[model samples]
Target: MRNLIFLFFIVLAISVTSCRKDFSTIPSFGQLEFSRDTVYLDTVFTNIGSATYNLKVYNRSNKDITIPTIGLERGNSSNYRLNVDGIPGKTFDNIDILARDSIFIFVETTVDVTSVPDPLYTDRILFDNGTNQQDVDLVTLVQDATFIFPGRDPISMEIDQLTLDGEPTAIQGRFLEDSELIFTNARPYVVYGYAAVPANKTLVIDAGARIHFHDNSGLIIDRDASLKVNGTLNEKVVFEGDRLEHVFSNVPGQWGTIWMREGSKENEIHHAEIKNAIIGVLVDATTSSTPTLTLKNTQVYNHSNFGILGRGTSILGENVVVGSAGEASFAGTVGGSYDFTHSTFANYWNNGIRALPAVLVNNFFTFTNDQGQEVIEPRDLTQANFINCIIDGNNNVEFIPDRVDGATFNFNVSNSMIKFNDINGSFTGVAELDFTDTNLYQNITLNGFADFRNTSANDFIIGQASDAIGLGDPTAAAQVPMDILGVIRTLNPDLGAYQHISF
Candidate 1:
């Protein structure tokens, strides 16, 4: 009787184990819920990979269900790809989800225009099989682009790099060829690395040309080289990052700057929009008496650093607007000659705490020497003038004049609106900060009302009630007769870049 009882207990344990293994999942019956009915992957340059997006597959029913087949409508040849259960493929089978739970389906795409056969690349992610099938639509816009990248060595796998000061550097770049001097508007140019202009050569960008740069990519004009951007009022040139997604449109520091390096001469940019860069335009130090950079009717916004940073260079600007920078909107450091008329330098930086002013003018800089000693270099600021310009921001001080006393710092800000509250008395006893001086600062409306239409949206048009509507100097307005947007400025023009307009 004891042996029989032990055998019965063993059989009971086996039966319980078999019953657990017999549990089953129900087949999906067109009841799967999805996060969205369609996924718009956004526009992208051809042959460029898009940002990854996810779709949540929820099983709201009480029973655990198994999707028999999850496949793309185009089968294995589709441009779209899927990742399920740590495996990547175009088709998956037996995808199971628990009751009242959800599983994510990640999607990505890299398509070529030539192979897509159509401008709109469409695909569908089909779940299950036969009558119980459910699908999510996938759509993307593919754009053809003229790709520019540095050449690589086949054997060593080494990419061409820029050499600085007779030493090899990690900056991946190559000088542009002779045939690539002119950039037209036929197709957008997508640059993967720094495209350097050869010495003594000139690169011309025609109107309506769009230049998109990847991370760290920029345009560098070498010694004696020049760059001319001829954009019209209606068809303006655009320089921005390669990301065409909506969320990345206004994000700053996506790429580098359009650097007119040291010794580069006669750089001119007109009617261009430069955004989402470390620096919109960088005019390095030059000994030439003429203007290093001529910027006219240009708008530079959403820059991580200065919109236009001039270092010991001469800049002549008219009808220019720079808005919202992490640092200054326009920073003339190390003693540069700047002459701006009918321009606006506004900084309503909302990203984080910004201690610097919107417009910064400093004549001195410090650096460490070879012998470990810190040395101070003060250059003469021959001219730092802003006529009929508005330099304002959310900070108490939007304009700072930093002089080291060892150099000649001369700035005449006449007929302009400025924001200098001096909340902490930091500029107390500073000769340059004295706003009462007629020679340095004249006819300035300090902290007066300059009602911008919408600073958050970057629309800097002044309204009728704004104090700057008729505060401009007539002589200065004549230099920049039209506003940045091609509107004719009145005889008594506004102080900022734009004339008074109805909101």
Candidate 2:
């Protein structure tokens, strides 16, 4: 009985010690360490939530410390929200930190455009009381956008989807109405899903219009519909993902392509920039008999796939610049007709191993037949001409001219800088890419440097030291009198989309 009572007393003592509270804490003396002195919330649209960011708070002292108050400087009026440890609130009281321990503080924001007094909304996370206070700065840029999203069904609650063949598709999108057919520079347009142009309708974008797409969102032109971008030299139309943050500025594949279906005729884009997409421009089934699209003084950059994909389509390009694609910068596949004058097609992608060349023109496509056997289908390549252009990349062979037996393949490259190194004898038996054939290749500078001005900065301007200076065909220069930057090309013109800069 005595031993049992002793064991019971010992167990009771252990339980009491464990249940005892340790409320003793020294006030924080402004010695709190932070993971970052300034937390940038990136950029967010008006009334849209920002990506969640985190910051760590450390207590270096050996003794436990109590923060008198942890809150935003603006208190309840601030647009920011803080989650201290696990609890979320605008302000917290008596937050304690164990000895030499740290806690994570998550930050998020959603601000209204009208509520923000300036472009940048700022606040501070304050710690402790008057004399023993420490603070971490917070900053975020807020932009106003005209948002367009699909509506949900009233009864079925099904999200709106793109229509194809009289049935809804998995693509979350809706067709544009008559009133929304025109876009202006009044505000930046933010598209949530695919904004499809209805059949036989035209979508017009005015100069200086900025169109931003969300993830997997893009613009699509339906059959018999057209797209017209009326941009000018001073005011260019911009198409990109809606991240708006500095980190995502040059990132690729944030959105989908600008796809133009067959029968979408008379499409034009001039002095515009299209970037950060899976494919900058995708032309499907637009045959080479007539001009499918006209691209002039435009820039396409940082695409995950081809910069300009032409599937049996015809395109007339002048002073067009394409840059940095995972696949070919410009791909004219399935036997398309392409004419590019005073243009630049360069791929300096450092992302991964690229199997495709910078520029490719093929006269055939392959598919599996009913017997599950691969079959080649040939299409006639009417014309693929590159005059006074620059087709160069990091690869040894930057241009590929593919030809199949059933189709007629015609191509000409005159007074251009190209990169074609067949050191491995890859084309020993292929007659399609014969460099000695003067009829197909004329005045070509084989494996020569164009000497671009800082390709890493996406600056394709030709430097004075470049050998391509004064190497352009005079007739082609006369056709495209002005360069992409509105500089008049002299009779002794330079190759590529941009003219030679003295610097």
Against the reference, the lDDT scores of all candidates come to 0.89, 0.90
Candidate 2 local lDDT, 269-333, one digit each (tens): 99999999999999877743667899999999999998999998889999999998999999998
Per-prediction TM-score: 0.92, 0.89
Model 2 poorest ten-residue lDDT run: 150-159
**Model 2 bad stretches (over 4 Å):** 1-25, 33-38, 54-64, 85-88, 94-104, 114-119, 152-158, 287-289
Best by lDDT: 2
lDDT of 1 by residue, 158-267 (tens): 37898754677797877889999999999999987788898889999999999999999899998899999999999899999999988899899999999998899999
- Report how far residue 444 has shifted in candidate 1, in Å: 0.5
Model 1 CA lDDT for position 449:
81
